[model samples]
Target: MDEKENSTEVFFDILIKNEVVMETAPLDEQKEYILPDDDYDFHAYRILLLIRKCGIINEPFFSHFTIYGRGKFSFFDFLIRYPFYLKRVIEIEKKPKLLDNLKLRSFETERALSPMIKYIRGPWDHRYDGIFNYMVSKGLIKVEFTNFNKSKKAMCLTLTELGIQISEQIIKEEPIWVDRMDIINAIFPKNATNERIDDYIRKHFPSLMLGIEGE
Candidate 1:
């Protein structure tokens, strides 16, 4: 393994061993057992910390950029909800046949393009694994598996306290991206169903709904 992978593995070993003991230990002992500063890949560490604070939950879809935006316009939300999709659109633009193959037409606005592109792309991107794995290894987030039956399983991601704290600090220091709130909010409104989200996107961002039936 490379340095970062090796370091992260060592960190996970320490974290898993200490998790139970730390829960029952004295406050000072708990603090002492926390991941050491020197052991972290600082860039990845900071990214996860920032993401947590921004209220963008990392849902671990097939793509690295598939995080959900919740509660407001934060940098993490912008990264996942906008720039990531924009990059995908750019890729599509470079190859018009891609849109044609998917039975989609390019839209002039992001509102129209975002959802359709995401649907067509199907969230398979794995570029964010480095940061994700680092966060997992450091115990800032966890991976859980649910076995539904003899042949099915589902994986879920949830944050830990340390992850929340770091993300909060990132928010406190960075300026909010106010303009993108409507789009972000539409993508993940409070308790909305997939059907509702689809309806809302189609109604408000018509460009995204183009070439799809039942609009």
Candidate 2:
């Protein structure tokens, strides 16, 4: 983390950059992101979208997200939204494939760290752990592992080109504030669960995967 880039204020500025990009997007794509009375896609549309919009460029992206790191609140949520808004986001995935066990990384034990610090607070935990094992299983993400180490080892991660493309195409449509409102309305509506939130989300955001009603 760069000293000048990790502060909370820097984080908001990072968001401001995307917000600027968002302003350049076609107005037609800026429909209100209301939720449905029912289902949604929290992964493809949401996760990918967060990364695209929130580009993995700086530490600010996680400045706010680390707050929810103790829980599985999906930091990827705020990062991926507008695929067209970010150019560099698609660039990060251009690295070589991660040959599982081929590379390694070691994290210093931080008993002083909070629970949020241990986990990335997003879906990367599994990817980092199994070397995209499950992703390889699904054929969504692939990797080969070589060389093993146990005592005080280093764990290196290699993200593939497909991973970058996947990140771009899987982004969600809802912005942070919008999605939050949609979720709040869904889980805690004026009358406790309004169907309009569901209807609106479905109409404008047909690609979402996570259900908010029970959340």
Candidate 3:
């Protein structure tokens, strides 16, 4: 019929496709709500709202949709696209700590889903190197490539003073800053042991740990 009605129909189709709610007989009998005109941004927002109503998705995915729209992103794409988000999470405690590449890779692999994982093909992909190099060029972070006994090479990342200030300001403006900070604290507590990190991840993100072994 009209644009709103058309959008509602599309939304219903998505819900059915995802099996979020079963298709009912005579779909016309089902009531639909008015949505904004069939624009890409509005459509994406509507899909997110419907998914939330279905109670099927979780954080990062939820937040990612809110921030980046409906375009499916690889985990590397997520990191590259929202480097600041990851930076904010890593520096939530306001300390200039060294975040090793391994830790970053581990976090992404564990948290990102199948679609994202399949898209990125893991953290070692060249796409990730590009993102990091871009951040370096922007002076948002400092990277040090270290060679250990000429046998192993590792990259260490640290936020610059400017980066810290910018991240803090951005985090403060977030509506869910408090809740986000609490989650970060739980994930990376002070003086945290390997056992403690494992316990926290298992307790909080058990779904993410599926098929992933303890570190």
Candidate 4:
């Protein structure tokens, strides 16, 4: 099959996997699309892959006010939750061909199941805190502080040596994810202000910026 057909088939597989549509029934027979909650191992693996590839300075923020500032926290959710959005961002920024490396296909299979993936938004998934806490308990990551301003230190999440070693192993197992995180990192480089990320999200995904209650 051609690439488009292959991508379509992959998307259908995702829908079935997520129970968005009945696997045994026709594709038209839809089910309530309840978002799937990722398991600890799944979240752990992706988080490791993210930190491994992006490194400390470019890590996704745990919160906007803490790392970035207002609306910037969504970048974390964007990378972790929205694969197709990441793909589109890379395409729009004229980065390297995405499918060329198939860097995010694993993520695409899980989160990019539909073309409307970009429009899907909700409350920040609280599962992240649990995942980070678990990783911390295992000594995979540490909380460090960087100079946010003259007086304040910004909290930075960084991988430990063990984290780095395991992350490398993850890379060896799935090299396709090599530079996928870097594409987003390059767009929001070290010391980039919250406004920069906030503005970008507002421009591209205004709907997402709105509160879940539509504030």
Which one wins on TM-score? Answer: 4
User: What TM-score goes with each of the models?
Assistant: 0.36, 0.22, 0.32, 0.59
Worst 10 residues of 2 by lDDT: 63-72
Better of 1 and 2 by lDDT: 1
lDDT tens digits, residues 91-128, model 3? 64454352332133445544432122222122222233
In TM-score terms, candidate 3 sits at: 0.32
Q: How many clashing residue pairs, candidate 2?
A: 39
Write candidate 4's Cα lDDT for 87-181 as tens digits. Answer: 66767678765545435556465644212222223224456668778888988876555654554454456677787788879888865455555
Alpha-carbon runs more than 4 Å astray in model 4: 1-36, 57-77, 96-99, 102-123, 144-152, 212-215
Q: What Cα-based lDDT does every candidate model obtain?
A: 0.41, 0.30, 0.37, 0.58
List per-candidate RMSD values in Å. Answer: 18.0, 25.5, 18.1, 14.9
Clashes of each: 6, 39, 0, 0
Local accuracy of candidate 1 as per-residue lDDT tens digits, 22-109: 4376766665443422334644544454334323332333212112322111222323434434334435336443332232223432
- C-alpha lDDT of residue 80 in model 2: 22
Clashing pairs in 3: none
- Least lDDT summed over 10 consecutive residues: which range in candidate 4? 113-122
lDDT of model 1 at position 139:
71
Model number with the top lDDT: 4
By TM-score: ranked, best first: 4, 1, 3, 2
